[model samples]
Target: MPENPVLDPKRIPRHVAIIMDGNGRWAKQRNLPRIMGHKVGTESVKDVVKTARELNLEVLTLYAFSTENWKRPAIEVKGLMTLLKTYLKAEVQNMVENDISLRCIGEIEKLQTDVQKIVTRVIRETAPKREMKPSLTLNLALSYGSRSEIVRAARIMAEKCVSGQFDPEDYSEQLFASHLYTGGLPDPDLLIRTGGEARLSNFLLWQLSYAELYITETMWPDFKGESFIDAIRDYQSRERRFGQTSEQLQAE
Candidate 1:
């Protein structure tokens, strides 16, 4: 059972996405190096993953690094990559033990060779097998940009059409989504952004078309299981009518 009294277990979101923000701000507030905040943020990630497993969440997508993040100082980018590598290496065994499958969505080729190797290894090791059905799928969005993803999918569809493998008239929302990086995954049910940011930050623009948004002032380093539960609780309070009227939803 969930620890939160207000959270309805039956109403839990199947897929939840988060944009972890404020690492630099958090470090600056503490007069520490920005990398320090990122380092501590890894601990929060562990906590949230544990919580997600406890809640039986089907999928958790984390916005780890964006394509635009490459514009930051070289040192910071290096530090972030190192942190990512360390996190994956350290968490692989834990994820396997916990039956959490690891997945990545983005331009993975853009990552360093060593980081790519580790990512590939982790994904291979944590993949769900016939006898080992994963309890959760943890997706890390690295070097990801929604616009670029959209364009990539479009290019693939166009090429298929030109090759006579696909018809131009076959383009539909469902068919287009099949070409996306998140083709096999459901769209996020909720999107949680830390650091009080309300914008999407070029993350999952299409997948988050109808996801409930939860913005928090808490920094990524400070967001833990309790904070996550609070977001879930808030989500359960809302009535997601999609495009239907409240009366129509009630009638159904």
Candidate 2:
């Protein structure tokens, strides 16, 4: 078992997002194919999800694959899709038993029909689970791009306005957010990126505007429960002002 800090429930982030990176580089260092690194990285996923659920996290969004990822070699893309399908199929029973529901926030239609079927089945099977603390949701951002998500939301809002379903007087930030892919979920309070990367990499741009970022040098395959604990601790140490001055925050 991994030793971890006892987090304060009041300060714990309601939603956590991760950009899992460095698979290819980790594999290269070992003189193995990149696919092998991804395979090992899946283990890290399972560990992190289990830990998050144990910690009572409300939502965990993983940047599993991006629209840009499709530009990789055909064989590598195929391998990734196959691995994802296999993992999803195998994890459905575990999800049901643990009360962890699955959700996909991306161009899900872009995925192969068989893979989509597996995802839909798992989601349906886990939908009725209500035993988990805080109701865990594991969001996989496959074929996702933040810019496209925003544009899609904008298009929907525009159509509503044109059809007289929306009024200018009813426009608000809350309304805009409701049309996003992450519609009902709270914005991520913490965004973590592994493998030493510092950029968002076009992931969750609008949603993460005010999220606390925690970057680490550890690669995805090596990141586990302890690593997540460290990040959460770091987040707890910081003060979120949300554009207010320190004095203003102190006065509040």
Candidate 3:
């Protein structure tokens, strides 16, 4: 792992979100089955996670599968689920050994019963490790759609109001955010999309409100640890004023 020469230790992102894209395209380019691209992408996942842990990143969120992903071919969906199960089974030990907590932020219950069982088991098994402040949390956005998540959060808040457990007048950005799927976690400070995608693609709409966006043409399967470090370094070079003018930032 080569150190990123330009990364500032003082300005590490508290949360980093990634859109791992182009698996099928990567495979198509190589004249291989799409699943083969996914298999290699899993290797990228491993490398990225290790790199995040080494950098002491507080939270790392991966756009693993989206609610819209169900529209893909059935065989591809099944293969993805199988691959997820296998990855979970194999990585639980690595997560524990590294004091990383595995978390899911999507409609996980909608997964196949068998896949759900494996996900649940791994989550339970890794729930106890906490060696760092944020414990290098790795959140997989499975079957996740930010719009649906926001709607669900609103529904819950509405129900709370109806039940008199909440006061509508007490609402604030913070209060409403607490109802989100990523309620307790910090909003992503940096959002990286690979395989040349320049859009959010409906992932983390609310949480990425002010996130610095980095788009790379590298396919997910080929994105390595050094690539991740480069993203961080790029992020460190930008100014994040959060609505403040440059003059205001300088004055402060």
Candidate 4:
């Protein structure tokens, strides 16, 4: 069992987002195919979800597949889909038992029909479990772009402005945020990228504007509970000012 931290549980982040990277490198390091690394990485997902829910995280979003990921070879993509179906079927029961519900972000329609069916079943089955939301982004990105999301939101706002529904004075930061896909979800406090990568790679362009980042050299397949906790502790040590000066923050 992992040791519990000494701090008040209230200090834990309400939402945590992760960019699961380095599957190919994890497999290549051992002269194995990248697909194997992804398979093992799936197990790590189960481990992290179990630990996180126990620790009371309200939301966890995983960058499982990105719009850019579709550029990869066809065989590898099919393997990932198969892995998703298998993992979801097995874990959904456990998640429901533990009070964790599921959600999907990004373009989920590109997934194979069977895979979609399973995902739907699990989501409905786990709907009653509300302690945590476990979300996956299939970024099928079929054509997802952050710039595009912002432009789309602006267009909607423009339309509203032209109509009688929106007042110019009501257009605030909160109003713009409500127009985002992640509008209702709490923004990620800590964004993690494994396999030593430090860049955002076009992930969560809007939501991560104020997030603290943690990069790990450990490949995604090897990312376990201890590694995850290290990232959380690193996050806890930082100060999130949201644009206030250090002196002003201290005064508050």
Q: How many residue pairs clash in each candidate?
A: 0, 0, 0, 0
Ranking by TM-score: 1, 3, 2, 4
> Which scores better on lDDT, 1 or 4?
1
RMSD for each of the candidates: 1.4, 1.8, 1.5, 3.4
Candidate 4: clashing residue pairs, number: 0
Predicted candidate 3 versus true structure: per-residue lDDT over 1-252, tens digit per residue: 684475677899999999999899999999999999999999999999999999889999999999999999999999999899999999999998898888898999899999989988887888853543446889999999999999998898899999999788977789889998888889999999999978999999988999999999999999999999999999998999999999999999
Global fold similarity of model 2 (TM-score):
0.95
Per lDDT, the best of the predicted structures is 1
- Estimate candidate 4's RMSD in Å: 3.4
Leading candidate by TM-score: 1
Q: Which stretches of candidate 3 lie over 4 Å from their true place?
A: 3-6, 129-134
Worst 10 residues of 4 by lDDT: 135-144
lDDT of residue 237 for candidate 3? 88
Superior candidate under TM-score, 2 versus 4: 2
TM-score of each: 0.97, 0.95, 0.96, 0.86
Residue pairs clashing, model 2:
none
lDDT of 4 by residue, 1-252 (tens): 447565457678877888889999999999999899999999888888876776688777788877677788999989988888898889877876777777766656777788879978877887753544443311112223466567768888889999978888889878987886567778788898999988887777888889899998989999987778878888888889998988999998
The alpha-carbon lDDT assigned to residue 185 of candidate 2 equals 88
Native-to-model Cα distance after best TM-score fit, residue 203 in candidate 2, in Å: 0.5
lDDT of 2 by residue, 14-38 (tens): 8999999999999999999999999
